[model samples]
Target: MNESSVKPSEQLSRTLAAGSPLIYVVTWEEERLEQMLARASQELFGDDRPVWQWTAALGFTSGPGADRQLLDPVEALSFVVSESVDAICLMKDLPALFESRPALVRALRDVYDHLSVRPGSMVVSHPSINIPPGLSKEVYLLELPLPDADELRGMLGSLNSGFGEEQRVSDEWLDRVSYATQGLSSNETRDLFHQLVSEKIVDVDAALAEINLAKAQLLMKENCLEVITKKYDIDKIGGLSKLKSWVISRQKLFTKEAQAARIDVPAGILMMGVSGCGKSLAAKTIPSVWGLPLIRLDMNKIMSGGWGAPEVAWERAIRAAENAAPVVLWIDEIENSFGFLNDSATSGNMTIFSSFLTWMQEKPANVFVAATANRIEILPPEMIRKGRFDQLFFVDLPEAPARIDILRIHILGQGGDPEEFDLNHLAKVMNGWTAAEIEQMVRAARIDAFTDGREITYDDLIHNIYRIVPLSKTMSEQLNALRIWSHNRATKAH
Candidate 1:
């Protein structure tokens, strides 16, 4: 089994047996971690060992003179050293003290040495990993992941048991609720459940919408990942038959049959090429096609340092995406994030880029990455290499047939009949126009017709086509270079 799949208690047991004096658990779910630590202490010590917890607000919690409130950082470390032995010490606020208190850092190192000889262990639980350089080697960092489906189902079951028989939902409801709440922490999930129950919102669809809204609010708090509630039907998208076919073929990868056959889930696909050619549209449509929730990773937010350091932000975003697995992660304009792939790149950029590449290559199978890039040239070769992405699809300007499909879709979308207009002639005339440009032309013509109190006519479309200059005509040289570069490198998405 993968390390990520390992249970927290099991991971703790293994880490403890490795003789790691200090363990740093990175998570927001302190209650959940404490419960796991309690179980781990029992298994390790062959009895119920007192798990002492220390906080800045409430000093040393459960020991002799525990009520005395040993509030000082130095005093707390001294307590762990002199008093707490053959037990687990959980320091809730110690990570924050490292930067301001060098003496506390030195004391922790001494405690590390002392714990190596003793059976007791010190565990630091914080939401973020911020170890001082001096104690980095001595600290074992363990990130506690969010609740998975099984755990969520168990929570749902527990909650359901409290409801009246008439109010209780089916097992199917439990499964759906569990799947919907994948990315939430145990506490968050429990709170959401209570809110839903109080509101009497038991219907699966209604509950899912509430869950998604809650999740969106929680995940986007950092501005890294946004839950994409807007879904596009794959069939409504014009052209990209090959890409659509590829998607159809992989739809079964998530099924039990595929698992039974030992088939590997697809890593993801990289859609790169011309602008306004449905790359973003395709990214949005994929989750709908596969029947999964979609979340977009804002590379801009990750690198902006508005939330925190870019590297830390990226890790948190990736973790959030993984926690919400069996879902699609859309990274639009991916090249912007790793544009500093050249030698002049800063160490921070290099670290973020390397981390991105590593995650893409070895990401959890359930998380399908749909990355779109307009300028593939700026992206590193390693990023676009074969194994990093399942396939590289070049989405160029729509061909005549595809243009007709796009025109029809947009015309129908604008409440215009395609048969009334000369679609073949229109498609022929808009030879180099992209799907977006075509849609825009259709929209402009509809607006003109609506203003004139008449139905949208072919002449109106033709008139707007002349008024708007397509990217193909203006950026001819760039388009040619992109076509030539992708001709041999990527499979055609048309």
Candidate 2:
């Protein structure tokens, strides 16, 4: 069955209607979920089944028999079991309290066991909860998703006053605004809207800037993904014309029009080649040209075991990256992270690998992956399969034309006139050097001229080229092996 046929609210109603006694809903937005749950309750439990809530801060504030304060976890569970009425009861933030009182955990399970005879439903809500093994079987886990575009638009539309064009915003403009605020909570969107409104003037451009900042902060708070604040312009990288052309052609994949046409978004590309051959630079800068946020994901950091196990952190990172949609997830030195995927002995590594592979396969289209690898053998066969990623490109050593382009780009970038230097001679001599190596040559050559207190000369560039040993010479065997592997398996990047 297609999952998109049913909305989240409808699914919640069905779960409760099917007599799932103890539902554990996960979300950070308490108020929003509570209202949604109330709607769900009325549909399943009828108008007379009073929906109530209890919390540590405000105990028994929203229900009947509101005589006493049940601030303790033990008392809350006792209240749920003791109250013999057809009323839905929700307990907020119960895990920590239950952690301290093991008796409450057992009591909760017992409550779940007998809740079927009571003719009511009990729900436990929290941002994230660790379900004890005792009650794991008794609880139905449901994650409350973030508000979608339609909900966000309704909230923003109410606050919008004379901001859009002709006193009415275009649908395209509204959609972009909606997409920009995709990852935010209802409360967060409300706060941002009010903040924008307090200036007493409305501007779509100004509002979008604030929304992007808020959305980025929402992703960063997860601690798994880091936002690339600085621009890595795709046009700055020289050479690799084939790869650049492929990337440029697919720029419209992220647009609303593409969505309307049901165009499949580009999954991603694996850039494998010599260490300094613009592979990493291409991965970093492609998002800029695509007009998407670039987020660097640290695989090791997620697996470091401080927050939780590697699998747990890995899932969070994937979800967090998806939440920041229209994003480029740059995984650098990917072989180091997934080398163990082929081993039967390394179970932990295999688990992380499996989780990542599933996410990449099933993830939302808005999250584009740009993974870079230097060692091809270490990558698992499953990782290179067509469905896992859109394509894999080999970033080979720069040819003469590519080298000249690299030389002139870096030379101009460093404020030296490419016209003043013998770029042809420099490019010819820089045979077998990668783009990174050529860039370093340009940099080093400038320093030589800087020490002499004058502009860099063509001879200075030639002089610097002799002092450096390119990666091709140092790792010739490895480079050759990579080239052989990519011959029939991957497309040529340059």
Candidate 3:
């Protein structure tokens, strides 16, 4: 099934209408899920088929036994079975009880049996999926996705209409604000919009920045995925003409017209080659070029078990990245992270590896993955294959021309005039230098000139060029092997 094309509400309504005796919805947005359930209930079963909500704090909040104190899980299931009304019962705070209370599990199974043949359905909602073995077969899982752009846009419009014209933002700003709130829940989105209106911060740039800041904070709580705030312009990066052109050509695919035409979104490219050769910089630049948010996945954290088991933590991180759709997910030094894909891989590592391959192949179109690797030889063949990544480009050591471009950029960036230096001569002298090395050379030269109380001169840069040794010389054997590997396997980025 094309999960991306189908709306969550439609999926829920279908499941409920198909007489799924018990449904397990995994999501943190209980309020939003309830709203969807209420609407789905009315449409699927008419006004008479009421929607009931139950929580440990307020059992039977809305239903036949309004405000009834059936805090016990077994008792709650008993009440639902005894009532047996044609209704939708939303049971919150019940997943955690499955393991500790076997009686509650058996009771839920009974409720399932009772509701299977009837018009009623029991929905268990929780922030995560944790079904005990006994009731696994009886539960149908449905994950509630984060709010999409259209939904968020409608929400922004609804909130904006409540304010005076003087405080209102333009439709363009509304679109931007909606995109900015991609990863937030409905309640959080509403609260953010409320804050914006209350504070009268209707300026487009400032409001969007505030929204992104809030989103980054919330997403960071997951511990594995980080929202990258530092922006890099694609134009700032030197050379890689082919890769840059390819990226630019696909920018149209993200446009409204391209979406209307139903063009496939680019899966993303894999950049494999020397370290410090601008692979990571290219990953950071893509989001800025496309006007999308950038998220970095910390593989080390996933393996650390700080969030949970590696598999569980991986799922959480992937879900968070997908939630922030129309975003770039940068996975840097992927080979080092998934090194277990080698013969030494454990059963757990193999599971994660297989799952990652499948996810890369089938991930949502909006979640563009810009992954970089310093050791492509360590990665399994299946990972770098065609379908997994749209293209694999080898980022080699900067050629003389690219070295000159890198030098010029870093020079201008450091408040020095590139024209003052003999770039071609410097590029030659720093032969085989990585982009990162060149950047450092320029920085060191600027410091030298500053200490000497003069503007940066060509001699300042020349002095550092002789002082620093490039990675191409230090790791010549590895660099040669990488070049040979990419000759027949990947396209050249330069």
Give the top-scoring candidate (lDDT): 3
lDDT for 10 in candidate 3 is 90
- How would you encode candidate 2's per-residue C-alpha lDDT over 260-339 as one tens digit per residue? 68899988889987888888889988876766677888877777776588788888888888777767899987877765
Q: Give per-residue CA lDDT, model 3, range 56-173, as digits (tens).
A: 7778888986767788878888998998688999999999777778798889899999997898789999998898888889999998888887888887898889888888878877
Per-candidate TM-score against the hidden true structure: 0.81, 0.85, 0.87
Model 3, residue 449: distance off in Å is 2.5
Across residues 315-373, which tens digit of lDDT does each residue of candidate 1 receive? 98898788767678998888766655344467777788898888887788778899999
User: How does model 2 score by TM-score?
Assistant: 0.85
TM-score of 3: 0.87
Model 1 TM-score is 0.81
lDDT of 2: 0.79
Question: Residue 227 error for model 1, in Å?
Answer: 4.8
Worst lDDT 10-window in candidate 2: 338-347
Model 2 regions lying over 4 Å from their true place: 1-5, 18-20, 41-50, 65-68, 73-87, 102-120, 132-138, 161-170, 193-216, 219-224, 302-309, 340-347
